[model samples]
Target: MAYDLAPASVMFADVADVESAEMEIVHWDGGISIVPSGPVITRDADGGELHRLP
Candidate 1:
């Protein structure tokens, strides 16, 4: 029998800095996945790219 696998939600915390900030990424089957090619960049409310993650 074939089984359907639903999308999975992954969360990553800044363990290096031990900050309260956390990042969440949702993976949908057959959908586009957000893979960070470079360092994680932070953005502002205006959709601007801030500094990269350490």
Candidate 2:
């Protein structure tokens, strides 16, 4: 997370991008978090799977 940027500013910017991209966001009773679906696999130069991110 970026401590320099205000939380609300980051959130609003991300929300705006999501809106423009037509992405989805989930609102829960506690708060909200949006996880882009599918397996985001990172590969090294050798084409080996290095990590899997959400």
Candidate 3:
């Protein structure tokens, strides 16, 4: 018989947002250049930082 392995739990529900870091955005023309780093934070329902992945 085959068994189902479906996930029955919230992966990142209880995970709290500790801090936020910047994700560097790069642009290269002829050489490597660092442009800007965008917001790498997950926001909650009230526009708050939820969980920052990296």
TM-score (all chains, Cα) for each model = 0.26, 0.29, 0.25
Candidate 3's residue-wise lDDT over 1-54, tens digit each?
Answer: 111223441111122322553333333333222222332343334566545443
Residue 48 deviation, candidate 2, in Å?
0.7
Worst 10 residues of 3 by lDDT: 9-18
Instruction: Extract clashing residue pairs from model 1.
Output: none
Using lDDT as the yardstick, the better of models 1 and 3 is: 1
* Residue range 28-48, candidate 1, lDDT tens digits: 563322234334554434556
State each model's CA lDDT, in order.
Answer: 0.39, 0.38, 0.32
Runs in model 2 deviating more than 4 A are 1-38
**TM-score result, candidate 3:** 0.25
User: How large is the C-alpha RMSD of every model relative to the true structure?
Assistant: 12.8, 10.9, 15.1
Best by lDDT: 1
